[model samples]
Target chain A: MNKRELFAQIQEKKSFLCVGLDPVMENIPKHLLKYEDPILEFNKQLIDATKDLCVAYKPNTAFYESMGWKGWRTLTETWKYIPENIFTIADAKRGDIGNTSAMYAETFFNREKSEMGFDAVTVAPYMGEDSVGPFLNYKDKWVILLALTSNSGHKDFQVLETGGQKLYETVINTSSGWATADQLMYVVGATRAEEFKQVRKLAPDHFLLVPGVGAQGGSLADVCEYGLNDSCGLLVNSSRGIIYAGKGEDFAERAREEALKLQQEMEQILLSAELI
Target chain B: MNKRELFAQIQEKKSFLCVGLDPVMENIPKHLLKYEDPILEFNKQLIDATKDLCVAYKPNTAFYESMGWKGWRTLTETWKYIPENIFTIADAKRGDIGNTSAMYAETFFNREKSEMGFDAVTVAPYMGEDSVGPFLNYKDKWVILLALTSNSGHKDFQVLETGGQKLYETVINTSSGWATADQLMYVVGATRAEEFKQVRKLAPDHFLLVPGVGAQGGSLADVCEYGLNDSCGLLVNSSRGIIYAGKGEDFAERAREEALKLQQEMEQILLSAELI
Candidate 1:
């Protein structure tokens, strides 16, 4: 989705919340195992429960890939199940050299090639320009580059000083020149609330896909404090907190409750910021 | 495979070559289309032809993933077909937060979970410690981290000066502490011949998975000049140059001829270095 279309969805739903459809079979509700594919059923119910309350669905491909080709089949089915208006992100952190990156891009962005075309795909910036440039070739698709990740490992290399700036900062500055806000987004962990301010200085116009808000202990208010822009430039993702909220038969309803709470909070934030 | 076993295989074959099974549907020979699965048949023939000559087989994940789940199935079948003595690498270049990386580890290393067990999987070091830590959890598996890549974009973030050390250098130094050389390896592109000397200084013991030979214009001689360690710490890869060497019914024979040429070159190098 384009920046304007994404912002429009956020305003219409009164939310910029992107529900993470990351399902693990053993962790899913026991009763759902009766289905042909428990993970697919689980994801379908989650989407049905929370689709109205959120603007996007991000599925981390690792969860599906762990299950093998069957899991990949589930991922493609799940992508087909999502509503077209809502943005879909293949949260597969993929990157490579130029020619290889093109194939990776085709996997996530070209339905004719991979039978799964996500609205956006998270990309790793380690290999640099050519690795990221292929995803930008998909006109309306988004490339969410990893920056200031929430994991503890983020400090290992991302925060190291590079030419008087943090490595993540260098990532932003160099990558920003590759594409504009229209087609590019950044994955800034919600846990790095303080760093959000610094990130804003470098990339004010680009939307940030914020993970770690719910299960990873990142505060929504702290993230929204500086992360919100005129475009509601943030997609705060909550995976386990919302999807695995309850394991009972009413799990989908329970998920909606969790999503509704976040949507309500987002609505208030948008109203206060006069963004809606 | 562990370091000793890998070196043993290199000595046994008198070659430290890795065949890259990166197949494109459009690129395979036209006659192979008569098969139920052209790509699988193509890979089977290629493997059968060159199994004795090379020490390892690295099927880049992008080629399979581009075809979607069916492609993933092909990858699983291909992995299962490789000889147990030869090392297998899922050249996925995958990385994510800790938990997510764990899932990726399962996808490539834990065959029970993913139906594909590779000896090593190439990982991107953009996220640092936790991202790479999970893959090391597997007893005999290896994590080949991306260091100096073989593309123009390698100049982007990889060469960025961080605390007076290059980013790729920092990747090696910090990551070396996470796992022993037995479990960890680095991808030093064969194209980056001059950089090999510097890389050797930081990671003298770790094996290097060198891509960008043949088609990418990397010299095996230049790489062996500074890259060869006592354990024969290099697995030079050539994808298009070896696999697509011919486009006719005699494609498999043509591929063998190409692989045989490299195997002979590698044999000479091993003999000269007295590594055999």
Candidate 2:
């Protein structure tokens, strides 16, 4: 989806919430164990509950990959389940050399080849332009490049100064030349709200996929305050916080409640900013 | 496999050559198309033919992922088909937050959970210590961190100076604190032959999984000149150059011939260095 279409969805929904469908088998409700693929069922119910409250659904590929080939089947099915109007992100942190990266692009963007195509893919920018270039080759498919992650290790190399600017800044600045904001977005952690200002300066028009809310102790208010643009360019993801909200058969209902709380807050934020 | 076992295998085989099993469906021989999974068949035959010739097999995960669920199964089966003595690397350049990265670790390293227990996995260092720490937690497993890649985009951020050291150098120096040479390795491309000299100084004992030696325009002799240590601390990878050597019914034999040439050259390199 393009920026205007995504913005229109956020405006109509009055929320920029992106529900994370990261289902762990052990964390799943016991009643789900009766199903052939418990995780897929868990994901479908979660999507059913929260699809209206969120603008996008982000499925981190690591969780599915952990279950082996069966998990991959679950992942593919999960993608098929999410509503097409809701932006879908295959949070597959993949990047490699140009040729290999083209295959990754084909994996996530070309549904004809990979059996699933996502609206956007989370890519690691360590390999630089050529690696990220292949993904941008897909028109309207987004490449959310990693920049200032919310994890504790963010200070390791990302915050280090390269020349006069920090590494993440260099990443944002250098990679901006490779693609316009229409095709590119940045993964800036909600945990580091302070970095959001610096992130905005470099990527003013680009949308930022914010993680680290809820379970990771990131303040949604703080992220919105510094990260939001006129278009409400933020897709704040909350995985463990919402999915594991309940352990009973009413798990989906509980997840909806949790998503409702976030969506309400996002609606308020949009109102206060006069974005809605 | 541990450091000692890997070195011993190189000495026993007299070849530190690592044959890359990155299969593409369009590239496979038409004769193998009769099988249920031609790619898996291609991989099995490649492993069967090169098991004795090369000490390692690095399957770049992108090619498998591009085929969707079937591709993931091919990856699992390919990992299972390789001989126990040969080092296996799921060249999945993956990294994320702590918990997510742990799932990736399970995806590639934990056989009980994922059914594909690879000895080593190529991890991206963009997310820092916590993202990479989980992979090191696995006993006898390896984390070959991306340091200096072989791609043209490697110069984008890797070569930039960060706090008196290049980004890739800082990556090496800081991540070295997370794991020892036994459990940790680095992906230093053979394309940048000069950078190998700098890499060896920081990591004298660590095994470097060197790609870009064949189709990527890297010379084995040049990589060995500056990158080699007493234990022959390098696994030179050649994917397209070796795998697609022939296209007919005798494709496996042609692959063997290509592998044999590299193995013979590696044996000579080992002999001249008196390491065999």
Candidate 3:
């Protein structure tokens, strides 16, 4: 989806929330196991319950890949189930050499070939421009490059000073020149709320797919305080906090309740900021 | 395989050559299309012909993932076809959060789960220690971390000065503390021959998986000059230069011929160093 359309959806839904579909069999409701594919069924109901509450769905590929071929099937089916208007992101964190990266782009962006056409795919920036170039080839699709991650390990290399700027800052500055805000986004973790202000200065207009909220203990108000832009260019993601809210037969409904809380908070924030 | 076993295999084969099985369907011989799975057949033949010459086989995951579920199947079958004595690397270059990275380790290391157990899986080090710790949980399995890549884009962030050391150097120094050399390795590209000496200073004992030889214009002699240690700690990979050496029915034979040339050169280097 284009930036304008995404912002429109956020305003219409009164939320810029992006639900994370990182399902683990052990975490889903017990009653759903009777289905042929419990994960797929769980995802379908979750989407059914919370489709109107969020503007995007991000699926981390590791959760699916760990289950082998069956897991891949589940991922493909889940992609098919999500509503098209909601932006879909393959949070795979994939990057390689130029030619090899082209294949990865085809895997996620070529719907006819892979049967899973995500509107965007998260990419690791370790391999540099060529590794990220292929994903940008799909004109309308987005490449959410890893900048400052939420994990504790983010301190290992991301914060190191490089050429007077921190490593993540160099990543933002160098990568910003590679593509326009419409085609490129950055994965800036919500854990570092203070860094969001610094990041906004570097990438004032680009959308930041903010993870590490809810289950990871990142505050939504602090994130929005510094993260919001004129276009509402922030996709705050909540995975386990929303999806695994309840383990009963009404798990989907319970998930909607959790999503509603976030949506309501986000609506108030948007109103106060006069973004909607 | 453990470090000792890998070195023994190198001595047994009299070569440290690693044949990269990065096959592209469009590049394979036309006659192979008659098979039920041309890519699998091509890989089997390539392994059959070059198995004796090279001590390791690294099938880059991108080449297969681009094909979707069918491609993943081909990768599993191809992994099953390789000789057990020879080292196998799923050159996946994957890493994420601690819990998420564990799934990736299982995806490549746990044969019971993923149906493909490789000796080593290349990992990107951007996420820090937690991202790499899970991969080290499996006994005897290796995590070949990306230290310094060969691509032109390597200069983007890898070589930037950070805390008086380059980003790649910091990665090697910090990661070396996480795991012993016996279980850890680094990807030191052959293209940067001058950097090998510096890399050796930081990681003298850790094995370096060197890519970018023939097709990428890296000289084998230059890489071995400062790269070889007492254990001959290097796995020089040549993909397109060897796999697509010829496009006819004799493709396997031509591939073997190319592999043999590198193996012969490697054998001479090993003999001259008196490490065999």
Candidate 4:
């Protein structure tokens, strides 16, 4: 999916919040464990509850992946559960050699496969274009390349100055040519609100998938103030802050409450920005 | 497994090869499709056939992830098929918030739900430390962070000069402090033969996971000459070039042949470096 359509969805729903699907086995309701696939069951209910309040579903691949086959199966089924209007993100930080990356593109975006149909994918920029370009090759597919992340270790390297500019700034400037904003987005951690101003200057038109809000303590207002563009080009993701909001059997309802809170805030932001 | 143990395995086998398990559904023998899971069947035979020939088995997550639930199961089963002596890698370039990353750590390294025991995992360094630190928290678990990539787009950012040093160099120099060489490694794409010398200077102690040596047109001898350290710290990976050497019924046999060829070359490099 391209940024234009994503914006339309946000306008239609009056929300910009992207619910993150980062299900933890133990964190899931005890009742789910009785089912053959607890992860899948939990994910289905979560999607059912919050799909209408959000414009996107960001499934952090590591969560399902850690479960091995069962987790992976859960992720696939979860992808199917998301509504058609809501964009799907395969939060798999995949970036590899060219041919290998091409297959990754096929795995996530190819319609022929039984796998989930993700509108966009989170890509690691470290491997450069060969790892990312293959994902971009698919028509209308979006690649959310990593730039300045919100993590504490982000200071370890992402903020390091190289030839005057920070490493992430260089990544943004250099990778702009691989694909257009229509097909390429970036993962700019929400906690790095200060850097978004600089990041916007680098890729003024591209979308930014911002994590680290809610549970991680990143300010939503600060992110909107600095990160949003004219098209509402930002997907703010909250995983633990959303999915694990309540540990009880009413987990989905609690999830909806958390999602509603974000959506309500996003609705106001979209209104002020005149995006809706 | 820790670096020392992984090295010991390499010494015992006299090979520095890390065979990539990137099984494509279409690439495997057609007969395997008749089974409940073609990808799993192919991976099982591949692991069984090549277990003794190499010291590490790196399963690129995208290949199995694309298969949806069935694909995930195949990855789990494949992980099970690999012997304990042979190090296994969940080649999933994962990085996210601290809480999310911690769960990812559990997913890949948690032995409690033991169907698969991967010794290490490939992580994207773009998110900085919080995204990477969780992976390192586990004792004996190794995080192979991306350093210099082999893709054409790699030139877009990884090689960009930042404060006189390239972006990738900064990632290596900065991330090295977060974890010891025993816990951290770097991905130096084999295709970037010219940059290995510089990468070695920055990360002399950390092992390098080198991809693009075969089908991607990278020179194995070139990377070995410049990238090899005193510890023979190189896990040269050949995915498509080795795994899909032939598409016929004897694909597994052909895969063994291709792997053997690379193993033979790696053995010579190890011997010449006096690592054994």
- Give each model a TM-score: 0.99, 0.99, 0.99, 0.91
Between candidates 1 and 4, the TM-score winner? 1
Give the candidates in order of lDDT, highest first: 1, 3, 2, 4
- Quote the B-chain TM-score, candidate 3: 0.99
True contacts kept of each: 0.90, 0.92, 0.71, 0.78
Return the DockQ of model 3.
Answer: 0.79
Q: Candidate 4: global Cα-lDDT?
A: 0.82
Q: Please identify which of the two predictions, 1 or 4, would achieve the higher DockQ against the true structure.
A: 1
Better of 3 and 4 by DockQ: 3
Evaluating just chain A, the predictions reach TM-scores of: 0.99, 0.99, 0.99, 0.97
User: Between 2 and 3, whose TM-score is larger?
Assistant: 2
Q: After superposition, how far is residue A207 of candidate 3 from its true place, in Å?
A: 0.3
Docking class of 1: high
Better of 1 and 3 by lDDT: 1
Give the Å error, residue B183, model 4. 2.3
**Stronger candidate by TM-score (1 vs 3):** 1
* lDDT tens readout by residue for model 2, A105-189: 9999899988898999999999999999999988899999999899999899999888899999999999999999999999999
- Model 1 lDDT, residue B125, Cα: 93
